[model samples]
Every structure is written in C-alpha cells, then in structure tokens.
Target chain A: MSMRALTGLKPIPPSEITPREVFLDRRRFLAGATAAAAGLGTAAPALAEEMAMKLPAARNAAFSTTDAPTAKKIITGYNNFYEFGMGKSDPAASASKMSVRPWTIEIGGAVEKPRTIGIEEVMRLPLEERVYRFRCVEAWSMVAPWIGVEFNKLAALVGPTSKAKYVRFTSVVQPSVMSGVRAEVIDFPYVEGLRIDEAMHPLTILAVGLYGETLPNQNGAPVRVIVPWKYGFKSAKSIVRIDFVEDQPRSTWMKLQPSEYGFYSNVNPAVDHPRWSQARERRLPDFFASTPTLPFNGYADQVASLYAGMDLKKFF
Target chain B: MRSARAADGRFAWATSDPVRALKPLVFLLCLAPALLLVHDVLYDPEALGANPAETIEHVTGDRSMQFLLGTLAITPLRRITGWGKLIRFRRMLGLFAFFYGVLHLAAYIAFDHYFDVPAILADIVKRPFVTVGFAALVLMTPLAVTSTAGWIRRLGAQNWSRLHKAVYAIAVLGVLHYWWLVKRDLTWPMIYGAILAVLLGWRVWNETLGRQRRRPARVRARAEPGPAE
Candidate 1:
C-alpha cells in the first residue's frame, strides 16, 4: 500500500484561545502566582484559597502526558456525547457551541474535603499527555492523545473511604442551554459509574483536556474520565459529580437494560453480544479495508490484571 | 362512465395478474440500490475502501432506515392525499426494511467481528451505540416474524396492527442507533433526522386532523334528532 494513500487532504487547524482558554488561563495564572501576589497584591490570597481546595494535583499531574498512538484513539473514539445531542458523538459537534469557560467541577458527596474546583485550578496540576487506543463497542477504534490525571490520584484528594464501593458520575442536563436534551426523542441526564477498584485503576483518568489544549466541548470539556480497559461508555463524559457510593452505582446503559450491561464492562474478546459478533473491530486510521483489532485494545498488559478471577461472560 | 373506465385501466396496469406485477416490480426497483450494496459487501468487499465492513454496515443500515421510513410514510401519505391505494405496498416495504436490518446486522457479525460471540456480548454491554443498535435489531425480530399474511391472519388485524406499531419506535431507535455510530460527519445524520422529523410530523398532523374531523361530526350528530347517540 502506498503512503500516498495517507497524504493529508486537510490539516487539523491550530488550537485557538477561546473564551474557555482565556478564563482558565486567568484562573491558572492567579493560582500559580498567588504566593508572590500575597506579598505584592491583594489577588494572591484568593488564588491561594482556590489552589488549596483543588483535588490533589500530585497523581493527576503524573498521568497527564499524551503519546501519539494512544492520543489518536482517544481523540477520535472517545466521542463527546454533548455533540450529537445524545450518545457518544453528540458532544463532538454540539460541544463546539458551548461556552466552556467559567466552568467549575462540583466535588461533593461523601467526602471529608469536598470542594468546587475551577477548570484552571485543576489544570495547574502537572499534565502528562499519553496516547491511548479507544475502542467503541460499535466495532470501530481510534488512538488518541489524552491529557489528564490518573483517576486514582484525583480520587485520593477527596479521601475516599473504604465504605465507598462505587463512584457515580453525572453530566450537566440543562435543556435550555443544551438543546439536545429538550428532544423528547432521547433520554437525558446521562450517568455512568465504576467500581472503586475500577475507578482507581492506574489506567483510569479524570481527563481535563486533549490535543495539547483545554477540551473542546464536543470532547467533554471541564472534565471527563477515560477508563481504557472498559468499553468507552464506562468512562463517561461532561462529568459534574463524582459521588463515592457504598453500592455499585447505576450507569446509563445498565439502567436502560440490565440484562445486557454488566457492572464490569472490561474489554474482553471472549464474549459476544447476543445480537452481534465482537471478535474483531475496525481499527481507526484504517484509511482502508484492513486494520486488525488488538486484544484489550492493546492495553491488555496494563489492564488484564483487573479482571483476573471474574467470569467475563457473566460480568459482560 | 369515462372516469370510472379510466380508473379501471390504471388499476389494471398497477396490478395486472401477469407474473411480474406492480408491487413486486416496484419493490425490486426500490430495492436495487440496497441490493447493489449487499452485493458489494459479499462480492466486492475491497471496493468499500476504508472499513469495508463498516461501510457495508452503514449502507445496509441507511437503506434499512430509509425503507422503514418509507414504509411508515405510506399511511400518512394516503391520509393526506386521499390516495388509499398507497397502503398496498406497506407490508412489502416493511418486510424490506426488516430484510435490510437483518443484513446490516449480519455484516456486523460476519465481517466486523468474525462471529466472535463473547467479544460481541462484552461490547454490547460496554458500548451504548451497540446496545441501542442491538435493541433495534431485537425489536425488528417480531415485526419480521409477523410480516407474513399467515401470521397476520393468525394474530388478527387489531393485535397485528398494535404489535406492528413497534415499527415507529424502531425507526426512532434505528435513526438514533445510526447517529450514535457516526464519528464526525453531521451531514448524513442531519438529512435522516430532518426526514424522520417530517415523516413523524406527518403522522402527528394526520392524527390531529383525524381527531378534528371526528369531533364536529360527533357533536353535530348528538345535536341532531336521532337515536344514534
């Protein structure tokens, strides 16, 4: 096959400093410069207060790097449910219309140190960019560069108790602002959850942004989770709340149909849905008829241990 | 007499008792594009370019929805135009939709997953799009099973009609299922969404007009001197 087949038809445009960037940049600037300002300016203490409340920056910062292959998959396959109005890709297009600035993640529930953190305060953590392959159950896959913190590290800031067996995620459901939610055609207030162990997986992430910039609204701006071992939906998007639960929390898919959606939706090639086969997937960047799917989407070594003793068939 | 004679002539052409009649002919003609799509998947898989299986699945899926949407438009079209003859093809078109849906799913199984049952099951649980798409397929099963005259006769018209109304829900699911599967392009989904909106809008309009037509007659009859009430 010719490399000519892959020649660019059009280049991805450069990232712009949207209202979101300016707003976040201001917040980050304030938070980082707070120490100097405490002596020189009145703005310093407020910034310091904001920074102090942020979820622990240590672990989240360590997991922020994005490598090329993983980045490609994450960018394409991890769709923005905000875009198409519902489902995954809804965010990819519809998110572009959103004013993502002035966004704050509300962290409350069973937490000893609950706090609402601004996007800028979250970004102030050291960011690592990692490239991860994203596979959709729809039989297509993409590799993407994702930027965020390891979810375990982010969750640590809240000091999750042993009582918390699950982590529930909530997306904003504003119909007046989110016109897609107004459509009676689709159910709204999309929710997803992960078991505490799954939530704290080293591969699990609380992604802040992607492609070397703040997340595009279509890509789950503000923040989203990336659970590489599970089917893409397990990751959730446009996350607002991260409640630590004593029980396995209900996710949108499982709520829609429990017979099919299991709590542990780990990526396993061993099980097939009653309606369709799943032995192979269409690898994105396929650019043609043949790109073979990898087991565990090429993250088997990293994530396989999470599912050691479980029956994948029953769990699936 | 002349108008009646002309109507008879048109009916004869529309449904002459000969071997290849109008319904079958129109069905075949309407089915050609989808048939060509299926052929490409089976015979010329390479011709599909990037992701042949997905391209085929998409073509089959798009056509299935188009057929289902077309099938749904029949009654509303007849009501609006008073061309009740259009209802003659609803069963055929509906079956064709089922046929295409089955094929669309088959492509997913055969080409995409290579018949890996466990992996497919895991995916359905993991992916919302696949789950919805799978639900749409399951919903189609009974509709296809009951499409035949034998089953329809056995079930009776009222029960059969009620069971078949699931097609409307399926159409909505089918569109959503398709929309969810798409990566970036909005053009195709926007087209289908607009078309489905109009198709569904026509149904609502027809129902409202039907209710309005029945209301005055009911009131007037009650007002008239009659034992009917």
Candidate 2:
C-alpha cells in the first residue's frame, strides 16, 4: 500500500465521492481517470467464442473524443495490419485464420518483478471506453472508442527499476497464419518503443476491444497498444512482450526506414513523409475532402510536454 | 477444295467478319473498368472501401497499366497467332491506356493534392515515384494523338513505328512508378516488373534472332522488317 502511494500510482477517491467500484478496485488508475467493476475469469478466443461475452467498460467521456466515431463496419473492414496482408481490407478478410486464444504477454527486463500476464489477468484491471482520434502515418484518421486499462496501471504491477529509460513493445508473429509473416514483407515480431515518460503517460492504454465488444481478429484481438497522440504504428498490435529497457529500442518501421519513421512518431502535420504531405489527412468515407491535421493529433494539451525542448523535426 | 477450305479457315478470323464482331466486345471490355469505377463513385461507393480516393487512384492507375500492357501485347500476340488484322486494334488499346492514365492523373490532382498546383508540381518534381508516373503519362500523350490514320499518313508508317516504340519506355516507367511507391510488399510490383521484363526481353530476342523463327513466309513478307514495327 505504501509502495503504491510512493510510486504515485495509488487510486484516489473519485471526485471526493468514491464510486463503489473506485474504492473496491485496487487497480484503479491514479487521477481517477476511469472507474469500472473490472471482471476476471472471462476466458479467451474471442473468435472461437463468437464474442458473446461482453467485457462491459464504462464510457469514460473524460478521455473520449467529442467527434463522431467511425462506423464499426468500416473500422473492422478497413485496416493496415500488414501482418495479415498489405491491402487495406486484407487484415479483416484473413485475420480469422489466426486464433487469439491462450495469449500471454511476457513482462520483463529492467523490472523488479518480472512475470507472464495472461489476457484474462490483464483485463482484470478496470476497463474504460476512450474515444480517441487515431491518426495513421499513412495520413488517415479515425475516432474509435477503445476499451482498455491505462498502461501505467498495468506497469504499476512491477515498478520499473531506476535503470529503465525506455519501453519496447513486440507484437506476436504468427507465421502460420499471417501472410506478411510468411512472405517476410519487412520483418516479423513487429517491434515499437516509447520513452519511459511517454509509456507512463495517462493517454497510453493497452486496448483489448472497441465499440462495446471484444476486438475482432482484424483489430488485434486479445490486446494492443493505443497511443492516441502518436502515429498508429507507434501503438503496437497483438503485443506479445513488454520490456522495460535501458536503451531505446529500434521499431520495425524505424529499422525499415529510419528517415521516415522515428522513435517518437507523434502526429505532427509540420513534419511530412517525403513522399506526401502530412499537413492534411483524408478522413474515411470522405474521399476527395481533407481536414487540416492538428499537432500531436489534437492531444497537444495532454502530450506536448513529453517532447518539450526537443526538436520534433529531428525526432520525427 | 478441302485444302483451300482449311487455308480460308486459318485466315478468315483475321479479316473483316470476326475482327468486326470482336471489336465492340473488346471495346466494351476496355470501357467496363472505367464505367464501374465511375458508377462506384456515383452510386455504390461502399464497394470502393474506406479509402475510396486511394481506391480510385489504384483502380485507375492499375487499369492504365493493364491497358498499356495490353497494347504492347497486340504485336507479340499478332505475330504468334498469325493474325494480320490484330494490329488494327492497337490504336484503340493505346488510346484507352492514355484515357485511364488521364483519369489516374486527375485522381491524384483532385483527390490527393486537392488541385493545389504548387503542391502537386512540387510532389511531381520531388518524389521519384510521382516523377516517373507523370513522365509515363506525358510520354503517352503523343502516341495517343498520332494514333489516327490521318496522322499515320502524315508521319509515314516507318516514322510512326519508331515514334510508337516509346510505348516500351512508358511501360518501364509505369512499372517503376509502382515499384518505388509501395511501403513494404513488392509482390504486385515485382509481378508487373516480371511481365514487363518478359515483353522487353522478347523484343530484344526478336530483334536479335527473329528472322530464322517460324513465321509462315507469307506473313513474314507482309509484316516487313523492324522498320515497320
């Protein structure tokens, strides 16, 4: 109890009037960001189970976007999950080939208590729906209500040692099912990383589902990172390993093209991909129209301080 | 009488009746892709998926390349099938390539850059992918314009053959444009490249050793030398 308060991860009473779940929920995030009767013992394989079991999460409007959410059909059908295939619709079509059951994320490296956490155990932490503006590096945007726990709460289980400077996230490489993995499009076991501060940011979450349902196979079922302020690739999908490390890890995109993709790929319109302008993005369903892209993907007030004094152009 | 009838059967389709019958079908086949694309934009846009602008760009661009390749294919296919009049549809195929290439360009200009001239120009100059794609379209214009019988008469058949040979270069440029733009998977572009390679390689081989190859001596003389290509 003292250690949780010492680390500043202790859950305080919600708005000075504790919700029943807030006081009872030991794993509730700090700052009272979300409260829910987080459940456990809901077994895996969302694909096999037909997603009949709903993991009800509170719609935390505090973290939600005022903008309308993209339709679930479009969200599920249109994707950039290169693991399944390169085409936009390939993921949704072929992701059913892989099963999302018996999944476990290994937590280790530069942490005091390293342990393997199952999907069910990870979902035991309070769940909440956050409608976030998801900006992809390919210059597309979507507002999705993602359900998950704040990453800091998950990290709170084993406090990082003083040596930890960065966090590396690695996605599962299902070569047997993933067409890209079999073809070796870039590399398997896609890796992404974040600075210690960015990983611990309140906005960073490990999303398990979206739109009041367990994530479809296409959307990286079981668990995936949702870093709203950064480019979508910065949020690794189907994450298998979370390693708190001393040195910054080279992400898959960064390894593929260092000049184009940097470690801190925050959504900045000013910094453009050499091939195209990032100044504006074409929102889905509106083919010819484009809207001006906001700096830090409109989360500057929440995340801009993370990059203070650092030249974004250089890092980007 | 039986031998004469067999000979007539061989050359009959190459002449008016079947060629005339097939022209409209091929023409419709060529126009179908564009019509479907426009229909999707106007009516059933969901068929184009989430990124319809990008989808439009890809559909128009891919169809352009397909038509360009089909145009190139006419010569080799005519030679192989000994179909003398197959060459008549070459102009139509080339024109369709240009038409779709124009649509592809319009998609990029209207959707991608939103008619921002400076941005479009800057992108065309700065990115090698855009540069090659634009060059392919620019090079295709002269061939499409000179495809008429009047222009053929004005330029002479020999000179027109030399000018139209630029189709090979345009094909290469089209393939390179696709190759350079893809982020990771080179599978489709590589397939296109292989087809282009085979076509170009066959041309090189034909130029080097085609005189000895079996071509039905009558068709050989009628086809003339490389100058009439």
Candidate 3:
C-alpha cells in the first residue's frame, strides 16, 4: 500500500467497503466463538466488545483525513457538556435525563426567512459522514466521524440578510432537566457563535449522529455544530436556536474568562493558553504520549485564507 | 503500668505502651496511597483511566493537602481527647504531608513538563495557580528539614515554634492554589476552605482565651513590683 493509503488519505470506494452487518458479525464471531475456541481466554471477548463499534468511512472524500478516528468509547464517554456537570465523565452519567425528541430550532435575527424547523426536518436533510479532527482548548484531541449536513445548507435555508455578519447558536436550557444548571457553572443556555464566512465554510457541519448511530446524549444528541478548525467548545451541543447578527456574539467561555477564551478560538499552537502551553495535545485513550499540535489543528490548508491579514495572536 | 497525668490531673495515653505499639500501623496507613499508586502503575495502568499521569498527579496533590490538614488537626484533637500520645504522631504525619507534596511536584516536573525547566519556569511565573502552588512547596522545604530533634534543639524551643508557624501560611497557599486551579467546580476547594477555617478558628479561640487568662496576672505583676526588678 502507498503511504497515502497507510495514512488514510486515500478514499476507498463505497462498493469496495465491507457491509456493516458483515463487519459486526465477524466481530461477534471473533468475540464469542473465537474466544471460547481459544481455551476460554479471559480478556479477548471483553476487548473485542469494548472495541466493537466503528463508524462507516466518510462518504465525502474532501472531509476525510489521514488521522484514525478516536475510539468510540472515548469519544462517547469522555465529554465536556457543562449542562450536565463539570467533570469530563459527568456528562455521560447525567445526560440520560435529556429528552431530544420533538425538538425544534428557531432561526431568526437579520435573516430574511425567519422560521422554526423541527428536528425531524433537519435530520431529513442529506446526511454525509465526515471524519474530522476535534481539538479541545484543554490540550486534548480526538478524531471523530460525524454524520451531518454542512452548515452552509442550513445558512442557505435561513437566508441571512447582508447585515448578518455572525451566526449565533444557543443550547437548550431547561433547568428542571439539566442538573448542571443548578450550579450556575456557566451562563445558562450556553451560547457560541461563528463569523458568517466561518459558519458557511464547507467544513462547518451540524452533526446529528456519530459512530454510525444516533449521537449519544453525552456526545451532544439531537443536533450540534462541528467546526473542525476551532476549539471543541465552539461546537455548541443540543442546539435550540440559531440567529444571524451583525455584532460579534458573546460565547459562554469567553464571557466567563475573556482573556483565556477569545471569540475566534481557532486552534493555534503558537498562542499558548494563560494556564498552560498548547504546543502539544494528549490524544485520548493513549495517555502516555502527547503529539505536537498543528496550526489550525492541521486544517490550515483549507481555512487559513479566512484570516489572511489579521493577527491570530490578538484575535486568539 | 505507670500512668502520666495531664495538667488537669487526668490519666494520659502518653505513659501507656499502646501508643508506641500503634506507631507501625500509623506508618503503614501513611504509606498506603503511594503503594496503591505504585501497584496501579505496575499491574493495572487502566485503573487510572486514559490519563494516568494526570490521575497520579491529582491523587498525590490531593493526598498532600489531606495530610497537611491532618497535621493541623493534631493539636485540637490532642487537646479535646486529652491524648498526649497524639503529639508523638504529629511529626510523622507532617513528614508524610511533605513526602506527598514532593511527589506531586515531581509528577508535574517529570510527567507534565518532561523536565523542560524553561517551560516549567514560564508556567510558574505566568499562572497564578502554579505560582501559589510552587510557593507553598518552597515554604514546606524548611519546615520539613528543621523537623528533626537536633534542629529543634539547635534553634531553641521558642525559635523553632515560631518558625514552624509558617505551616499556617503554607496551608492557606495550598487551599488557594487548589481553588484557583479549578475552572468551574469549586466543591472540593470549598470543602478544604471550610476545614481550614475551622482549624484556624480553633487556634484563634485558644489564643484569645490564653491572652485573657494572662492579662489579669500581667496587671497584678505590674501593680506589685518585686525587689528583683
């Protein structure tokens, strides 16, 4: 195989790929039958089950990267959904109470066509799997296979007026349901925003599913934005509203600590966080080794032009 | 067995042999956390989850704080229970606190920064949390070194006692370091703060009462000057 193939840059055609059912069956056979046949090995079946879930290859060749996706367990289990709690593992345990069904998102503010769209209608929009690298501001990263539509499609539907320079997202804020709200850890109804061009960027997506299944609540169920070039918090989860505005919107983290979390939180290795250096990130499930972080989280080739003249250090 | 009497004429455990007998058990108890971490590193690294280095660092740091608080509680506990023997374990507990604190600092230097002194120094200078934590560790070094009987004798009881009062400042810095380190949740730090408040409050109460009791004697001494003056 070529280096590109080994690096996962080359896209395999759909027909050449193994079917999901066949793959799962092989996994089950290896887990159940092979383990028993191999004289009752203790760890084999458990390890196989732990590594069972795998998302289908990205259909959009443009979005596919040379990075392997993080383990499904790590992607689902380790999360930073502050609406549930502050601890990374708290969300997976506490987010089960969240009800995403019958959800509707209201899009308004400087948009010519203001309207409310149901979750079902949004889900029906053409979905494509995009494997993208996710970089968190806390110096951790993961490669996630997100299944969703481009934010441009959503923007096109909303019909933003010329005055709309930024797109703001708001998360669901039912304090009765979300226990983390009681603590007031952050301003409730967690808000995040993106520049109009950044929102319409081809790479920006509103993800509904991951790992070939409906998104787990801990991993932001229903719908959430995914901006590959920005910090993970910029991808607000369980979105309830999207508004187009002229002024730069205040993000939750930026509101809490303006110095630490800037509005344009693009992943820049050179701009170190006030607390620690961002030169390297600890890739999940591999705790011992930390890989050097890349500028724009290794997505600079596609998005670097957006900030051609501006200074990233000042903006960051 | 001969029994020692407290100032109030109460029998104290310091004269009993059981206090010395329990020293080994207390020593093992102090060593338990480090042993558990070593075992996890060797046999089941996954027990610490995906970030074992972080886990180790957090555990050691937390243990150091707990032991520091435990050391502070010895006086109050000994006074309340009339267990003079408790004072014997105070040095051991204090040494354990210093031991865990050093380990915590070692984990940050070795694992987190990979011994990159420049980067570590930069963090210490820039980050308030790291700054206070580093200061607390530095303050603890002298206390730990001068804890020996020889050093205490050389310094004299009054000077030794005055110098070791720095532990109170160390505890405050330690709590502040923890409080500043957390981004959102202040639950653990708040609990530590409450404990530190009570411990310090107890000392203040005792000192005030001591001053009140001594004031009358001081006034009488001034009123009736003796020939020695």
Candidate 4:
C-alpha cells in the first residue's frame, strides 16, 4: 500500500502444462443449468445457449498448472457465493432463481471513456483455458481450469486515466433471487478491489467458464475475476460494476473484519488468518491432505516484485 | 406437582416409565445421525459433499450441542407436563451428548489433524475458539464419567446434583465455542444460544420466582432426594 513499483516479469511457463486427461476425461461430469453448456438439458437449448457463451479455446500453456483440476461437480457444487447463502452447497441449490441473461457490466470511475459492456460482448473476447490453484482464506484449496479473457485485454478496451490507481469490483445483489441478499450477509452487493498493477497483471483473468463449459449459475454464471495469487474471495463473483478508482476500495471482507482480511489478501503462509492457519490448506478430493500453502499461492515469481519495496506487514 | 405426577403415573403406557419400552426407540433415534454418517463414509462418499470431514465435524458437533441442550430441557419439560418419569431419559440424553461430543472431537483429531499432538495442542492454546471448544469437552469429561447411577450413589445425590450443574457452564462454553468459530452469519449459533438461554432462564426463574410461589414446596423438594440427579 506504500511505495512499490511493479517490477515482476511474467513467470516462465513450468514444464508441467495443464494435463489433458484432467480436463478431457472430466467431460462426463454433469454440467449445471447453463444455456451455453454443450449438453443443454432443458427443453429450451437455443434460449440457454443464447444466454451462455461456449468457449472453443484450448488450454493456454502459460497460465496452466500441473495440478489436477478439482472435479467439475465440486468446483460447481461447492461454492462460496454468499449471495445464494452461506453454506458451501447453498449457491448450487439456491442460485437457480438468479437470472444471468440481460446482464450488462458498467465500467466507470477514473477511466478515460466509461462504457457498459454486455455479457455477450464480454465473453467473446478471445477466451482461453487457464488452470489455477484456487485457495480459500478458510484454508481449503482446489485446482480448476478456468476459461476466460485476460483482465488486461478487457482493461485495454476502457482506457484508464492516470487517476485510476485502483480497481473496484461490485457484484449485483438481486434480493428477488438471492436469499443472502435479503439476509444481509455482510452487505448485499459483495465488493472487492485490486491495485492497478495487480489488475493489469497477465495472471489475472475474467473467467466465464470452467471444465470447458459455460459458467454455472452457482459459479458466478456470466463473469467473475480469477486472481490466482489472492484468496478466492478477492475474485469477486456475479460482477456488475468495475470502477477504476483513485484510492484502494474497501472490500466486503475487509469491511467486516479489517484485521482478519486485508486489501491485499495475498495467499501468504506466514500471515495466518486470525481464526485459522494459512500455512497449510486442505486440497479438495484429497480433503485431509496437508499441502503446504505457498507464498502468493506459488505465483510469487510473477507477482512478488509488485510488492517489492513495501512492508507487507503494514496495516497499509 | 406430586399429585399431578401421581395421577399421570396411572396412565403408565400413555405417559412413560414404561420408559423401558421407549428407551430402545430413543436410543435408535439418537444413533440414527451417526449411522447415516457411517453409511455416507463407507458406501456413499460424496453424500457428505465436497468436504465430508468438515461435514462430519459439523453434524457431530451440532448433535452434541443439541443433546446437551436436550438433557437440560428434560427437568423443565417434566415440570411443565407434570410427568415425573420424564426424568428417566435425562441420563440417556446426557450420555448421548457425551457420545456425540466424543465423535466430534474424534473427527477433529483423526480427520482434521490425524492425531497430531503438537498441532492440536498448539491449536487449543493459540486459538481461543479451539481452546473454548477443548475446555467445553474437558469440563464434560467429569460430568460424563460421573453420570452413572453407581457413581451418583457413591457421590451422594446432593453432591451429584451440584456437580452435574456444571452442564450449565458446559452449555455456555459450547455456545461460545460455536459463536467464536463461525466464519459469518451468527444465525445458527444464535439460535442454539437462544435455546440455551431459555433452558438456563427456566432454572433461574424456578429458583427465584417459583421459590416464592411455593415456599412449602422447597421443604418437600429437599425432603425427597431427587433421582440420580
């Protein structure tokens, strides 16, 4: 939050590119109610496909990881979208009412030319599959192949002014659909933020699909950012607003418990979450396995230099 | 109250103590949740969902708190219904609470940490939530050990009764353990706490206001030694 210049270069692609069998064999897994999904189950295939976007993109080498992807069911079924409800399965069970169609994301704040981008146009932006290690602050993690356009590609569409030092993301709160919205779980519309450099980093992407299918309603449906280095909550879901701002935005978790959740919610083993240790994470399927959590979730080579001069210990 | 209980006793099959007839049913009912968890673990793994270990911990912990509260509820319920024989189930309910609590602790130790002593000790020490949870279980140990009729007879009913009152403190600690550990949304924990408060509030009311209402009843209550507490 203090003085630090972005100096990290893109990490060299590890020899272990995204495994083919990991994604290929997983096609048999059930796809949730998504119009864009290949096996569109419901009577109205055209309507569903219209609402969802199909990705023909191959798994990109650079963003790929060697880790096996969390089964699509677990990735789709077990979600932390508080809008649906607090339980892990609540999102999958309760998100059916959410209408992802007729969605438009408003981009504004300190940008040179602010404009609204529809879900269709947004999803069409050169999609690619990137497997990332998704770690939760609650000390569980999963690996998943996400299909989406890079954040920089989307950010390039809207020219940012010098005043745009930070990026604020806001998720839509539909009280009619989302029961958690009515429950008022830590403010209805979940808010998150990113430093301008972090936002522009190549590792960052706006994910729209998982396991080669359209994003499930529970899995942020139309759009969500995937910042592999940060905690999963930092990848705000059901996003409707992206504001380029002057100051760092107060994320929902940060607002709820500032001491526990920081603006830079980087996955750091040394900085333990007040309630639980961030040192080890339970990888899904291998639920009891104690896998040591890496700094920046093993993306330190690409992102650590961004925090070069600043003391990560600072309340800043 | 004695007259009501005596009158109710006439309908033994209808009310209980013929509680022997109901005991096995209640036992099976209590064992049901644990059985389902076993079934899920052994045959249908995914039934517990993505994190079965966490689910087991939650279910066992939840049932433990529920039975602990249920054990507390018996006295008030019996008093309200004028069914003295309802006292027979208290031991079973209490022991079940202890049983499920053991299961809860076992899941945490075996599944969560795989019996890592240093890690667990560090958790109990460093985390206030874990510490409170561990303390609640520790306090329950003596109560659980001394729950038998033989032990109650050895300890004397009055002393046994006084010792078992620690359940109230255990209840508080259990609720505090729950309240402290929740990531967000105090709804479930608050509901459990509310139930605990009501159970605790009933005793406080009986001790204070009920004492004035039935001054002579105090002598009668003292004259007759209650069941194995």
* Top candidate when judged by DockQ against the true structure: 2
Give candidate 3's TM-score: 0.82
Q: Kindly indicate the candidate among 1 and 4 with the higher DockQ.
A: 4
Off by over 4 Å in 4: A1-53, B1-17, B215-229
Collision count for each candidate, in order: 45, 0, 0, 1
Model 4 CA lDDT for position A6: 55
B5, model 3: CA deviation in Å?
25
Cα misplacement distance, residue A157 of candidate 2 (Å): 0.6
How would you class the docking of model 4? acceptable
Please tell me which model should have the higher DockQ, number 1 or number 2: 2
After aligning candidate 2 to the native by TM-score, how far in Å is the CA of A35 from where it should be?
A: 37
* Model 2 C-alpha lDDT per residue in residues A49-108, reported as the tens digit of each score: 353246679988878889999988788888989999898899987786666666799999
Which residue pairs collide in model 3, if any? Answer: none
The Cα error of candidate 2 at residue A101, in Å, is 2.2
DockQ result, candidate 3: 0.34
Pairs of residues clashing in candidate 4: A35-A48
Give the per-residue Cα lDDT of candidate 3 at B17.
62
> Could you tell me the C-alpha RMSD of candidate 3 in Å?
11.4
How far off is residue B204 in model 1, in Å?
Answer: 22
